[model samples]
Structures are given as C-alpha cells and as structure tokens.
Target: MAAEQRKLLEQLMGADQLIGTGAQGRNAQLSITDNKVCRSYLVGTCPHDLFTNTKQDLGPCSKVHSEGLKTEYETASSAEKAKWGFDFDYMRDMQKYIDDCDRRIDTAQRRLEKTPDEIRQTNNLLKQIADLNSTINTGLLEVSVLGETGSVAMAMNEMHKVRTAKHQKETAERDLKNLQDTSGPSGHQKLQVCDVCGAYLSRLDNDRRLADHFFGKMHMGYSDMRKTWKKLSVELKGRAPPVRHHEEEDPYSAGPRSGRNQRYGGSGGGSGGYRRRGRW
Candidate 1:
C-alpha cells in the first residue's frame, strides 16, 4: 500500500509539472497556459488571470499540463476512494460543510466577545440614570425644604439627563440581549449540521433560504449520490444491484446537458464539484 501511494504521488508530481523546489521545498510549478484549468480552479479559489484583477507576473497554464494534472487527480482520487470507502465528491462536500461551520463559529465568537462590552456599557448607562434620578430627587427635596424655586431648574436638568441615559441604557440592553441570545450555544442562529448532505445550516435561516437549501441541486445531488453509493455497496457483496422503478426518477440527478449550473440549484452547463453560487 505504501509503495502504491508513493508511485501515485510520483506520477502526480511528474504529471502535474510539480518539479521545482520552492520556499516549501519541492513544489509544483505554476501552469502557464489557461489559469482556469489549474488545480486551484477545481477548488474555486484560483487567483490567476483576471480573477484577481491584478497584473502579476504569474505565468499562464498550459492546456497539456492542465489535462495531465486532471488525469493524475482522477487516478489518485479513485485509488484513495477505494481505500477509504468514500469518493472525492463526498469529501469535498464534507469539507465545504466544515469550512462553513468554521466561518459561522468565528462570527459567533466575535459577536459573543462584543456582548460583554455591550452589557458593561448598558450597566454604566443604567448607573448614570440612577444617579441622575437621585440628584433630581435631592434637588426637589431642597426646593421643598427651602420653599424656593431656585433648585427647580437644576432638578429639571437632572430629569432630562435621566431620560437620555434611560433611552441609551434601553438600547444597549436590547442589543446585549440580542447578542447573547444569538451567540449562545442554544441560540436561534446557532450552527447546525445537516445529516443528509453533511452541510452547515444556520438556525436563523429564513423559510426561503431553508427551502432553497433543502431543494438545492448540490444538496439533493449529494443525497442521491449517497443513496446510490449505499446501494452499490450492497450489490458489490455478490448480489445484483437492485432495479429502480421508472416512475422513481431522482429530481436531483443531472443529465449530460445539466452542466455545472445544476450543482448550484440552477439549470446550466458545467461538470462536478459543489458549484454553489457563493461557494464550491
């Protein structure tokens, strides 16, 4: 197994034009033909060409090099899947879910940090209001005790400060509550993992987004693929694959013309990988 993996790595390194030593030691050379065909392109993070909107000295990607790299990837992926009992597609889907979860958790943590500051600010404002109320009461008592109108103006000023501070305190408290509610583990916007497709879902997602996600092409396609994989696994045990009824058409199944657009819950042309609108 080790020898096989080593051979596969060597073939990949040679086929992918990864021959040069870089800062990270031996690394793949950048392609110099079409940037769209690079390995990073498959992950939707390619920064070459117009994608970065910069005129860097990055070279082009050779068509031949790109094809060879793709072939090597497919070959290695097939072997890896056979060894791991899962395909590259499934791995990519799970990775996307993980990335999404990380992003959400980061956001939630940031929000959670801000909540303490908000609570402190609100408490300070409340204290100010309370002090102002006491001042106003003291001023009013002075006016009544001395039977003079001189302290009435001072009491009115304190009342105004109390009103303003009360308003600010209310606003801050509301914000703090919202942050705590949403940033807490049991928050409405808490992170959720979809069991079917292994995707990260937001608890605060609206009806439309939830519907789109549930009915989205990528989610549905992955679900179908999982079912198919299970069926195939069962059949591989010296039994024929079960036949499906003609009426039981998978709505998420893509045809030849479906293209990559199908992966985004849209109808268009392109190949595999999670082809979502914002992320792959």
Candidate 2:
C-alpha cells in the first residue's frame, strides 16, 4: 500500500522525468564517443593491447584516456542519496495543496453553472430599464418642444405675447431717447413711422396702419417662418438660440418688397411682423 501510494505521488510529481536514466546515460556515452573520435584523428594509436592482469608492460588504453569515462560515479551516488532521502513533509504538503485545489475547482465549477442564468436575468432587466428611460426622455422632449397636450397653442401664444411686450417697451424707450436728443418740425409726431420702412406717419390711417402692421400679417408670417427655421437651425446647431431681454426691430430696411412678400405670404395670415425676428 505504501509503495502504491508512493507510486501515485511520483506520478503526480511528473514520474516520467524523475524516474528516468535513459537520456542522461546516452548523453554521457555521446561525450565519450566524441572524445575518442577526436583523439584517433589527432594521434596515431599503438597496435598492442593495453589490458594486463599481473606482470606485463602495458601501453595506455588510448580509447579510455581520450574519450573520458562513459559512466559517472558521483552522479550515481547523488541519485542513490536523493532516492533514499525522500521527504514526507513535502509529500503531505502536496497532498494538502491538491485537496485545497480540488475544493476551489469544485466551487468554481458551481459558480460557472449558475452564471449563465444570472447573466441572462441581469441583461433582461437592464434592457427593460433602458427602453423605459428612452420612452420617458422622448415624451419629455416632445412636451418641451411642441408644448403639452391641452396647452400647446396656448403656450406658443403666451410666449409670443411676452416677447412682443418686451419688444414694444424697448422700441418705446429708443423713440423717447431720439425725441429727447433733437428737435423736428412734425412736433411730437416725428416718432410715428412704419417700424419696418422707417416712413413717417402723417395721419390716423397711418397710425392704424402701423398698429395693424405691428399686430398683423408680418407678425404671424414671421412667427410661422421662425417656427420652421428655428427648428431646423436649432437641430443643426445643437443648442438653444441666444436670449436677449429686449430686441429692437430691424432699422435697416429688410430687403425689398419681393423679399418681404415671399416669406410673409404663405398659408396662415401672420399677425406678428418682421419685428419678431430674434438673434441667432
């Protein structure tokens, strides 16, 4: 039983290498053969036989001297000692280590068996959350852009109203300052003009004209154009347009009659005018 156990232990420790005498002895033979070949070529050999038992003049065994020894005594001695002095502690440690390794291997196998199911569950949950988050984000962006369900039109109208009020306040202040700066023959009426063309207003018709112009076709037309263009520009630019608290109407005449009519005369009649155009 002890021998069998020792055989098993040696097998575990690579018995093929530890138990062998084949390659080592063969290599020693090759060294001796090489030395002998070299000596035979370099020096002429004696014809006489070199072996003597008792009393005779003996010549050198050139083959033995030149080729050196085929067998190694010291090496054989060490092999014998190593074979005798086998360690029980090392064997016991190796057995313990192998036992621990087997336990770890079993645990790893169990973990691997459960991993695929757990991974599938985790992936499913992650996919569900990802889809839910995407839907929610889409809804929120739609509400923010096109406004809410019940109040979409209202929200747009309210925003336009606020923007218009702010613009009127600014224009009024500029007109007040211009009036303060210089004197003119039209008295206080020098301020009344087509805000678009800067043409002077001479009558109530012109005043009505300007008011109609202010809250009329140009306003609605420009607002519609802005809705389309602003959407396009914002998508391209990847950011919101800049905000100014108040903006003035374009002082420089906005192109020609052709330019104004082309943009302003689409489908919906515009109530708000070119004054509605904001900064980029």
Those runs of model 2 whose alpha carbons end farther than 4 Å from true positions after fitting are 1-80, 92-100, 112-114, 148-150, 153-280
lDDT (C-alpha, whole model) for all candidates: 0.43, 0.35
Taking the candidates one at a time, how many backbone clashes does each contain?
A: 12, 10
Task: Please provide, for model 1 over 1-280, each residue's C-alpha lDDT reduced to its tens digit, 9 standing for 90 to 100.
Answer: 8645543554567434433322232334432222223433332222222112222213332322244444444566544434422222222233343344345545544543435655676577566656655655665565465445566666566556656655665675666566556654445466555544445677778889898878865556445544443443333333221223343212123333123123322221112222232222
Compared with the true structure, what per-residue lDDT tens digits does model 2 show for residues 198-230?
A: 233443355676576556543333233334333
Q: How many clashes would you count in candidate 2? A: 10
How many times do residue backbones clash in model 1? 12
TM per candidate comes to 0.27, 0.22
Which 10 consecutive positions of candidate 1 have the poorest summed lDDT?
Answer: 48-57
Q: In model 1, which regions exceed 4 Å deviation?
A: 1-84, 87-96, 108-120, 141-280
